[model samples]
Target chain A: MLKIDCKDKHFSEIGKTIRESKDKEIVIDNCLGHRYIASGVGGKDIVINGTPGNALGSYLDGCKIVVNGSAQDAVGDTMNDGIIIIHGNSGDATGYAMRGGKIFIKGDAGYRAGIHMKAYKDKFPVLVIGGKAGSFLGEYQAGGIILVLGVNTDSKTNVGYFTGNGMHGGKIILRSDELPDLPPQIISRKANAEDLQEIEKYVQEYCSYFGGEPKDIMEKSFYVLTADSANPYKQLYTSL
Target chain B: MAINYIYPVYEVVRNASRCVNCKICEKQCANGVHKFDAKNGIMIADESKCVNCHRCVATCPTRALKIVKSDNTYRENANWSAESMKEIYKQAESGGVLLSSMGNPQPLPVYWDKIVINAAQVTNPSVDPLREPMETTVFLGSKPDEIVRDKDGKIVDNMTSQLKLSTPIMFSAMSYGSISYNAHASLAKAAEKLGIFYNTGEGGLHEDFYRYGKNTIVQVASGRFGVYKDYLEAGACIEIKVGQGAKPGIGGHLPGTKIVGDISKTRMIPVGSDAISPAPHHDIYSIEDLRQLVYSLKEATGYKKPIAVKVGAVHNVSAVASGIARSGADIIVIDGFRGGTGATPTRIRDNVGIPIELALASVDKRLRDEGIRGNVSLVVGGSIRNSADVIKAIALGADACYIATAALMAMGCHLCRSCHLGKCNWGIATQVPELVQRLDPEEGCDRLVNLVNAWTHEIKEMMGGMGINSIEALKGNRLMLRGVGLNEKELEILGIKHAGE
Candidate 1:
């Protein structure tokens, strides 16, 4: 393991150092809001301490990023394959356009968490937020699974208004009996045993990282939200 | 149905004297316009279904068929034209937004026609392009701000990555789902042969065309479809599509029906899922946010490939372009309102954006005024009709010109203006198997090469006439352009003088 002190280092210097380093396992300490840390870097395990800035693991291909402190916006932006474990909360668009990855945030996430998330053949992106999420949580989500556990929230819903607006595919599982005000295009239903069974792996993994009881979290009432139709604009236009 | 208010816009004129009863027209039309009546031993036409694409007229063995616009009159109302009334009737019946294809076909003023190129007459000797060396190759990207010298007293080469084009013309963005596979193949092949880049639009690059990675500009729109690690690094440059010229503020929704097989696989979405690219990149709200996305892409590609930001030419395009120049973008592409699309709302397509000529002039002037023109390169598109337009764009401060509608015409599009119907007999826009096979990629590529080669010759002639031997000398040389019958405000905005002056 190669430990490096990121004190008073420029973002580009930090990036170039990590890219040129031969070390397989690297640790970054004293990080202070340095954006794009470990961006598009794969084939290694990176552990970051202190607050990491926006786009923490953007385009991260087959790497593991462990953040000891909170992360800013666009944490896993357009990431193809990776595992990001954030011990604290994350800002807006935490998993924006992530195609294939697992982003586990111990605390809450800001707005547009899983916006435009999609899935390919064997790559299914999973984003699990321990606490509540902001508005437009799954806006325009095409595929992938988003789980909001509402770990310490007293609110009635785990997500905010306009959740799953224009969503065409994938599932948004929330640990709450009452649902938020959703757009007309989305359809929500109570998660049955099968639905819960499907997310068991993600839930167990989330608990193991954040120190929670997976059984207790899985036994709670949950609701699933999905788009009514993949073809939302079939009747929206008249050919001329 | 309430007396059938709509009427056929075209009339099929089949010459009875030249008719051989070959049934060729009936076999060529994809809109089912021509029907063979075996008992009657003749061909009947459904004028209502005729898009007037000229496919049958061009394919007829003999000169036996022609389509003419019907002289249908509706009281000759100047305020409400026939097209406007028909559009009203269509909306009343379907209750949906009107969709159109191709560029804006309105009788708007084309600035390219108003501007004239200046040639050396008396003082400066005109060099013949055939005799003298005329360079048309252009490099698009930011040049180094200042030269740095090393301790060894050697000048360090600080030039960033650039896209080198043999000519100032390039094929514009046209996605695979919106067009056919053969069309993409033709464009990829033609781009390779011409040493110019062809854009993948927002549809993502097909696996087959990946071989042309050196000449491909992979696009990353709001949807980010088919955008993964490999896709981002596959192209020579990456374009972040903010808005399209056809529909400035609206998002693009490729209907689920068009998503199938290769398109689905290439875009990495489900077979029937609608590929929706929202108006705004949700993550990008400000110029600072745009810088983040730009840097993120740079990081993804290891700062090897240049990043371009494309936006529609609107009322305040100069300001928007200025902001983009400062946002770390290597290139700024401004698409005019007359740009073509497979589908767009008719009203938005016709009324949303400004002309390319005016937009290019103003953006170039503004960037130069800010003293940051070297920070990024400018590539303008919307409707580059010919080589003259390309020359005018370069003189108006554009680094290069992107052509889509003209490129499609070179590939055998008849401008039927019915690409939204997905029954294009020319095989340029449709996705059906039989219809797609009609456009042979080899023939299409050859034609495209011929078109660009022809345009390059004309460009060289125009440059030689202006006493310029290279595209670099022609860049932002507005003094060589003169406006005819243009008002003071128009001339001022275009940064050109009157023809007499």
Candidate 2:
């Protein structure tokens, strides 16, 4: 257990120092509004205590970032392979455009959560939100699996309006029985046994990380799946 | 013989008496509507092929041509015109795709021609370019908020990165795979000669063109293709391509067929696989994330080269520009929806994003209001058609203009817009061995040089006409422009008054 006190040092200095150090289990305490913490780190376990600024663990190849407090926007943005555990609320665009990683958030998220998340071959990105998400969730999502578990009962909807807008590819699993008010372009259907099977591992992982029973999370009544049509979008202005 | 009862709905009348044998109209016509019949000792006209671009009418030396709608009606149904019926019949007969270029050339009310340029009459003395030294040279980089001086009260060396241009024009990014090697060489050579810059669009720089590094703006896109330590350090500046004008929300895709030996090696992609750049730079999500990449590139290159982020002009572009202004980017390159692309899904290309004029105006206004205009310089592009458009763009508030499709046209692009087919007969767009050979780099370079030189002269003349000498003085001086036949909304968006009124 290596604990580094980041009381007043800037994000750049602290990040540079941590990156150079060979410590595997590191805890950064009192990290207030510092950006790019644990960015581009490979093969390390970084535990951040305080509220970190934007771009937390960007381009993270292989690392585990556990943010004990809330995080600003763009958490785990474009991270290749990593496990991001956010114990508190997250700002807009959380896990945005993530390629290959697992971001498990235990709190609510701002707008555009998991927008543009994509997958390549065997490497698939998975984002699990334990709370409600803002608008434009999974927008233009080419690939990846996004699961939003509506744990908070205060909000009327699990995801806001225009959810899955311009979503060409990818599977979005919502634990709520009520279907999210999506755009006209996206087609939604009840998740079958095969769909639940595909996301079973992710749900299991989320449960293990957040200390919840996987069976309780999977016991939800229905799952909504949204995807764009095969020959989606016409050439409106120009001749195809 | 089956008699085709196709009536000419529009007659292209050419006055033989006023016609001159100069053939400027014939040369400029991309639709091949006009032809010079040497055996007949006259120019012939083919009205059937004409889409009525008016290039011939506009460029006719003797003003010998006019296009008129004929009363040859097929039916009284105004909903379906004779032209529309002909178009459907043509599509049915050909079983091929429809192609068009330059923009939605439909009568969408071009706001540019409506706006007018103002002149200095008596209040402000218009400096003459012929007499005084006019400064068109623009430095595109982050301007310091406040100059930090040393103890001696002399200027300190704490300035941010910037790109210096001899003129306010830059050759915009057209990738090696998108265009031929000869075309790229031509642009590189011309940029070197003219003291401007040419961009290496996400496809990494070719080793042969490294000698022209001084005038190169290397791009780093989503896929990080061709991005290495050496590639980053090669160019004068680095541009992070988030989006392009042609396809605002979509990524670029160079078909597998075009990715050859050098392109494949440069892009770091396997041969015969589509070089697809993901829509978003996977590493970037927020403004702060964008800053990391910006700083990363800066740190990678030892902060020697200025970093630019290119994005399409979308709604809320002003807010986006403000974000980019604070994103540690030295320069912000905003591409309008009217910009050209090598290959984009036809739908995405045409229907995405706002026009350059509106975007530029709003961005400039917003930055100025925020007092962060000094943080980054504006580089506007997409469809800068002529010297007049360049002048208008600068006045609308771009520090510099990027000309790609126009530059290619100057180097002899027929605007066939068949670049996706990769069989460009003009050698500007295609990578085919035989087709590529058609364009000589030296000649193409010369033509580009000639085009820029001509535009420079025209710019000077327009400036002179406005009684303004330097381009620096012309930048953001919207008083020089007035909108004609424009509504209040259009005029307000353009930041100009009605032309005559």
**Per model, how many backbone clashes are there?**
0, 11
Give the Å error, residue B29, model 2.
18
- State the lDDT of candidate 1 residue by residue for A1-240, as single tens digits: 878788999777788778888998999999999988888888879999999988889889988999999999999998889899999999999889889989999999999999989888898999999999999998899899999998888878988888998888888999986989988988889987799888787889998898978888887799988889888888999878
Deviation of model 2 at B422, angstroms: 0.7
Question: Could you tell me how far off, in angstroms, the CA of residue A209 lies in candidate 1 after the best superposition?
Answer: 0.4
The chain A TM-scores for the candidates, taken one by one, are 0.98, 0.93
Query: Tens digits of per-residue lDDT for model 2 on B226-281?
Result: 66556777899999999888888777656556767888776655565555576787
Residue B95 shift from truth in candidate 1, angstroms:
0.8
lDDT of 2 by residue, A1-240 (tens): 678888878666777677678778999999898877776566889899989987787656678999999998878765668899999888887876567778998888888888767665555788888888889888767668888887754665588888887676677888787787778877777778888886677778777777878788778754666675422333322332
Clash count in backbone of candidate 2: 11
Which stretches of model 1 miss by more than 4 angstroms? none
lDDT of 1 by residue, B1-501 (tens): 764368898999999889898988988899999998899998889999999999999999989999998987777577898889888889889999999998888889999999999999889988799988989889999889899999998999899999999998889999999999999999999999999999999998899999999999999999888888888878999999998789898889998888999999988888988998888998899999999999888877778999999999999999999999999999999999899999999999989999989999999999999999999999999999999999999999999999999999999999999988888899989998989999999999999999999999999999999899999999999999999999999999999999999
